[model samples]
Target: MKDTGRFFTVGLVAAWYSSNIGVLLLNKYLLSSYGFKYPVFLTMCHMTACSLLSYIAIAWMKMVPMQTIRSRVQFFKISALSLIFCASVVSGNISLKYLPVSFNQAIGATTPFFTAVFAYLMTFKREAWLTYISLIPVVTGVIIASGGEPSFQLFGFIMCVGATAARALKSVLQGILLSSEGEKLNSMNLLLYMAPVAVIFLLPAALVMEENVVGITIALARDDIKIVWYLIFNSALSYFVNLTNFLVTKHTSALTLQVLGNAKGAVAVVVSILIFRNPVSVTGMLGYSLTVIGVVLYSEAKKRSK
Candidate 1:
């Protein structure tokens, strides 16, 4: 039993990287080749699948209702958070359409900064000294990481920028809403609800904002195994990561867990380059290094503040 649990946890961590990094690269391709609209649609499809699969597993195993979310106010808040994330996904996906995976991931290093700012503004009166200062290096590193190449695609840049914002806001909101107890309040249960809510919200937005829906449907009908694998892996990976993240944080220190999560993203960037053979220049390496340092600094600063 002990060995089984240990193996399960190990599998969870490995799966986290596999699924998450998979989603990141897959979204990049879908965005670049198909369009942003396709990625958003794919997100919806993936989420719907995740929700169903999770619910089925819960039923099959007969785990005590893990933790179902309730409370109109809390659900509303979560749903709103989901909507913001939905928009963020759309923006990030579209950005990929117009950019290289390397550049896209490099630019995405800003998410930690955004998260810090959001956290400070919403709850804390201020960030710790190092946390605040870490922003400069992190931002600078992102600049250097891309070898100082800017995401010049006007619309894609805007979309990704929005995505960054959504990512920040959603994290904070999840922290807040997840505080309330529901009938079932585990990670799987929460995502089970959130995914559908997000998909429902995105359906209208996709219909209004993107004409790529028809194109995506046609592509799917043509039996693009690449697209299918990407979607499946992305969705599955996302669900596992979210669940593991929730469980790990509860078991370990939030800061430690978060730091690991941050480091994982950085590693994922390298893995993407290695696997996809995306361009990685000297400047980009420096930027990536600086970003790691900034994150470390930020973590230290935050620990002191606590």
Candidate 2:
């Protein structure tokens, strides 16, 4: 039975990862065409679509604990946290315009380090002395992996790092909320609150930041009709990300999830390299490898502690 569950989990993650990669590739193409507009619009669609899907599944399947929020406060809390979650995506996507996927994913691997820091500070009110210690290897690895590109943008780097921080905060905060309250909340109920919160926050952001820019960008990329389909599929892909993460987590240990997710950075790099044929350097590959290795180590430490 244990072997069966493990095999199922592996298959589940493989399918989930393959689908997500396909979606993100299409998403990248769409956003590249429509610029930031596609990213914002896709995010909205992703959350709402996934949430609605979860709701329907729950109803059709007659699942227990239908996941309805008990109070306005609970709803607000989930939404508020989800808003931060949404921002992480926006920041990461926008940063992608400036940096290569290799650099972007390398920077993102720091989430484990950041999550540990935030969890320590926010949850325990105690800081880990080793958090910075653990970060050194990751930083070193990314630098080695980035191939010392002279064209790197400092501002973009800052935004990407900021996105990492936001993701880390979202993880710890969501964990805290779920620990106390979300356990009782069904999958559908969680979506009910999460989607609205994310979509609402993204609205003003899209209008203020991406609205005027997207039209002009799309016009330039108009040579590609496929971009439209890619954008829609990308939106669906975003939702699947949420769906798989939930399903995968329930079936496997958090450590197992972390282990598989570590591949996202490297796999993204390989795909981006082959797809774009970007000039990736040996040093850059080395650094990327190191960063991922450090992240894996941090995850192992976390798992052992848990």
Candidate 3:
């Protein structure tokens, strides 16, 4: 049984890493190179795919049992989560528009720091001094990396930071809002509710911000239908990311997921640099190294403390 559990956990981690990296690369290609310049609309497409696929998995395939929001309060809580999800995905995609995947991921390495800060602020929970102190290098490393980044754009950096912070906030808020066993929605069910709500929320925003942009994409796609296929594949990969994340978390531990996430950032940077030929200065590499080391240290600190 232990061996079986270990094998399953390993498989889940592999799936999570592959799907996460795949989604990032696909989104970067679609948004930047594929001429699908509408990030918000692209986000809506991702949400739509997730919503549809999740419904099928739950209702038709019977892969997971259906779960419904039990009350108005739960609905509102889940809605808030959906809003955060929308903000994170859209902003992250927008950042990818102007930023190299390497730099965007380097910036994303600050998620743990943001998560700690948000946890303290929102829950009034205190952490060990070491945990707080360990994050100093994490912040400093990202700043150094940003300074040394050749492709750094202010708008992209800002959006990436916002996405990172929103992601952290979502993690904290999800824990607090879904603490009750009876009221808690499993990851797949949560995705089902959250994705649709997010799509509804993003509809007007996408129309206002990206409707014309999408129209332009459609016109461009007529000459090259590859654009449409890229968008569809990208959206499908986004759903795969959600599915893998849930499977990994459900089968393993959150700590395992966090550790894998840290590794994924490094993997993303390496893959992006190799595939996209992103130029990185020695100082930038050093800075990214520092940030990753700090994150690993912080994770260890949190684990030991617990």
Choose the strongest candidate by TM-score.
3
* Candidate 3 residue 282 C-alpha distance from true site, Å: 0.8
lDDT of 1 at 125: 52
Tell me the whole-model lDDT of each prediction, alpha carbons only: 0.70, 0.70, 0.90
CA deviation > 4 Å runs, candidate 2 = 1-7, 33-38, 61-65, 125-132, 181-189, 212-225
- Greater lDDT among 1 and 3 belongs to 3
Please state the error at residue 38 of candidate 1 in Å.
1.5
Of candidate 1, the 10-residue stretch with the lowest lDDT total is: 145-154
Clashing pairs in 3: none
Off by over 4 Å in 1: 1-8, 33-37, 62-64, 150-154, 177-184, 212-216, 223-230, 250-252
Ten contiguous residues minimizing lDDT sum, candidate 3: 209-218
Q: Give the TM-score of candidate 2.
A: 0.84
TM-score preference between candidates 1 and 3, better one:
3
Measured over all alpha carbons after superposition, the RMSD of each candidate to the real structure, in angstroms, is: 3.2, 3.3, 1.7
Could you tell me every candidate's TM-score relative to the true structure?
Answer: 0.83, 0.84, 0.95
Residues 1-306, candidate 3, lDDT per residue (tens digit)? 999989988888887888889889988988887767888998999999999999998999987899988899999999999999899999999999999998898889999899999999999998899999889889999999988999989999999999999999999999999999878888899999999999999889988987576678778789988888887888888998988888887876778777888888999899988888978988888889999999999998999889
Query: How accurate locally is residue 135 in candidate 1, as Cα lDDT from 0 to 100?
Result: 81
